[model samples]
Target: MKVMRILLGYTLLCSQLCFGQSKLHFIVFADTHDRSLGQTNLKTFHDLSSSIGFVNTIATYAGLQPNLLLYEGEKCNPKEIDQLLTTLVVGKDDVIFFYFIGHGWNNRQNNYPSFIFGNAYTDRATLETISRNQYDIYRRLISKQARLTIVIGEACNKERSDSPPVISKREIEIMSPQPYDPLKIKALFRNWSGGFLLSSCQRNQFSYSDLKGGWMSVAWQNTFTELCNDTYKRKVDWQLFLTSVQSKTQKTAEKNEQKQMPQFELSILPFNGSTPVSNIIPKSNTPVSITNAPCPSIDSYVNETALAGIREDLPLLHEMYDEIDSDNAKEYAGAFGLFFQNQRNFYNKLGSMVFYEATGIPDKCRPTFDKNTKWVFDSTNEIYQRISVINKYTSNPNKLVQQARSDLPSIISRLEEILEKFDK
Candidate 1:
């Protein structure tokens, strides 16, 4: 009898440890004190707060703990962020979600935008001191090694400039009650393992907002609420969620006579645990089609202008091969060579495809285009970085190098123009 009682006690302890509840750490940073964007920022905060509450309620129902750390108005500064990062502790089963909404701009050094925590009263130097880039924050959060890390920054990704205040009579509302299955919620939150980084707009683009809130934020909250309330869906598809958010945001921006497109990077690892396969939501398996088809201009430019530009630049690119002295130079030369050689064939295949008027590329071909464009962007950026390094080495740069450096920005701009036409 004594041995059986000891065995039963040990079994219960093991069960408690094995089935322990996970935690969700949500952090929000909002620059609500900025005079120009104060109202919009406040509205964003309220919307996100309600969203967090709904998440918390669902998490409780699913037997998970939820915690929120909010920094807004005067507290939204570098010092506070540093302190939060230093003290925050995350378990392996925990989820870390960091969101920021404020004025931001692209420094041209990276694809992501830099947050501007300064208000109208703050000076330029002080503003620079307080600013932090979205990617940096994402990296820091991921370093904590939580089960899942999601970082979202909803701000303009253009050159540094003051935006005029936007006014709207729309009022904020809390998330309404809906029939949500706790088991589905648990699967949605617990089945994923990876990092997700999202930005409001592409590089050199401006994000729009009004007193109601940021277009991206409002769209995200709405989509997320809908997903949670959906009882029929057994698993959450992140790719679909991102696509929905992007489409809703673009529509909202268009309604206001502005153009805004959200961008994201998702890296999901396969699950190898003992959890049932039914509960696991694998990474981005579902195909996501673009909401708005690419404009006719993209097809015309790629075939008529872009291909010719590449052909013309091929000779110069080949000539630079001999001047490649460093690893960076070699990499740049190689990437440019591949780009010039394959661009014609790639575009030729695209040109041959019959595009639908309503949906640019067919569902099967959209992924190929997306993958190729991403490679182009990455290769172009790599070439740019190599040029910067080569310039440092050669104080008296050669003519070919100088010309390549000067023309690279135009090339990037043209690429951005083409990508914009994709409506992604």
Candidate 2:
């Protein structure tokens, strides 16, 4: 009888442990690039500025104790980034990985569309020191049997100021080869899973950041921190999690005056919507297509365009417009556009509301800094810069993916449903 009781107790304990475990697991990397090449020295790159602070911020927010991280030139070998992935090759679970900083590629070559690790310094032994392999990370993630996965990149293959005036004819195609002989190559996803990837800049563009105190990437890191750390609650789905991240990130950036953009890809299967987002938990699997902006992308576009090639994005702007019916889309365009044109008046009302909402100090939160009140606006320099980059569609600078501020009314109406659903 005692043995039977003991066995039952053990089983119950195991069940509860599983219940409490977050569904998300992810690895993050920041400022990884030619550690040897820079206007800023290695010392600058190594500091724990706002960039790294944001990284740690998100880790804390997600209740995530990052298993491993590769920063700058230290743990940047392609192979080193992937070693941990080998252990997870068979686990069909959603995992998140982030990479930010500089990127280098054989720009002259038309071979595989792969970029070089930014540690442009040619020190082989230092490079070969074993760590995790990025390839294994990709493999474990792309496995269909894997749960779900998300990979976000905040690097540009080349500097935006240096990119050609033309967007590359090539599509951002990183889809792993179709399942051929799963018996041989076990990493691709067609057989079992889902995921997405978000990149700061496009194929021909460069992603850049104005380091806070000349250390680390700030804008990119802030967005991740706000989304994953502050706003995330348990039970939220990936789409909403992404939406919140994109929105709050901009707000955080704006407050700090950091300018840079952030982008991402999400998976359809793992994207949970149709209801207002209330919470978030960690995930496991692949990536997906993104949904609407946390705040409309129009405001960000206005500020972004004024900043030269330092454009940004908030997911695919066109896709957000496409979410509603055609009639609604047209209506939204006109209304949203008009509101932005008269933003001065709108700002006054929003500012007052925010003041009353705080019921405390004048400087505790910026207008947009209030995470609890969604109606008021969030306007800070860092938010604007982050939005500018994400809203820039850095991948296709020539293309205008945002609804001009002049077209916001209709856009807001179109968003009415989603917003109301969120209120519920």
Candidate 3:
């Protein structure tokens, strides 16, 4: 009965939206906790993807077609994540859209590693690590004859508090607008549209919940849907959603994520604090007024409040060299190095964003920090090779490099120094 009421309300809302706001078109799929699409799971994810404003934005408000409500009917897969993200990028301008939900995984090798319904398993890395490249996917979507683009990623960020590393957002910019490489899927997970990537946790942290008897990430699951369905129909602010999710997740821990404590985080790019984008939308040629963009470094954004996000999240540049020292970890180090190198590029682009915002948009919208993204494929590639070798070997033979890590000062200082140099 309740579901019917909600669906009915959505139909009514869609009717009104025909002449209402043309800003956002959100296509959501939620409760995707599964290895396959069973009838039960299908029902859950189907409702989730739509109940939230995600469905309303795409269908009711924006009124677009082929706009999907669910993919494979609960057969969550990497491509499903890609599909909604790509579709939202279509025709998006000025309005903000969201992909919010929870997921889980278990790695006896290293506590709970975050899970995508269907993705190649990654080491217990941060979401920003994943998102650094996903930006390219959004880039491809926006390039398709759209005036402006904005993305909101509210996926749960799961890291261990004891682990001390969590997810952080990186600046991703595409040199070209057109899709560069579909085969090169690395860029697909990055969030480079210069918009927001607000996950539930930082890099290596955990996201838990206790709503509806242990749904994937209930904090967002319970409230987000109803809020977006509001008669007021106001799009919920990212920060506001985070604040609410945190409180709700904690309360529902007995039932959500099937754990006692839940950790959630909200991050933003060009975040001015105190409620982001509060009823404000930037329009084409209207000039995006920005401040402290291109943050001299991550610390620029990591003050007391930002610290709450940072401390819980991953240390910016630290641990980047972890794979470098271990001969075994070296082959994989290329990917890890890629993580930091990508961040460096992002940091530069952020500064460039500031410069662009202060000055007028660049002649071609090029950010100043574009030069930093170059990676010496040879050196890093060599390390990447070693990483593979290490993984193959029984034990790591690169003790000499690993031992030198003791001399690199503290991880915090090293990370701080890296942040400072980028500002310089």
TM for every model, in the order presented, reads 0.58, 0.36, 0.42
User: On a 0 to 1 TM-score scale, where does candidate 3 land against the true structure?
Assistant: 0.42
Worst 10 residues of 2 by lDDT: 179-188
List lDDT for all candidates, in order.
0.62, 0.35, 0.36
Model 1 whole-model lDDT (C-alpha atoms):
0.62
Residue 390 CA displacement from its true place in model 1, Å: 24
Pick out the ten consecutive residues of candidate 3 with the lowest summed lDDT: 183-192
The runs of at least 3 residues in candidate 2 whose Cα sits more than 4 Å from the true structure, single-residue gaps closed, are: 1-16, 19-25, 29-66, 69-72, 82-94, 106-113, 121-140, 159-193, 213-217, 224-263, 270-424
Q: Pick the candidate with the highest TM-score.
A: 1
Give the distance in Å from residue 214's predicted Cα in candidate 2 to where it truly belongs: 10
Give candidate 2's error at residue 338 in angstroms: 49
How displaced is residue 398 in candidate 2, in Å?
A: 39
Tally clashes: model 1: 0
Which tens-of-lDDT digit does each residue in 354-391 have in candidate 1?
12122334555556666555655554555455444434
- Could you give candidate 2's per-residue lDDT for residues 34-123 as a string of tens digits? 432332223234532235533343333233333334445555455655554555433333334444334432121111113344353333
TM-score of 2: 0.36
Identify the leading candidate in terms of lDDT.
1
- Please give the lDDT score at residue 110 for candidate 1: 49
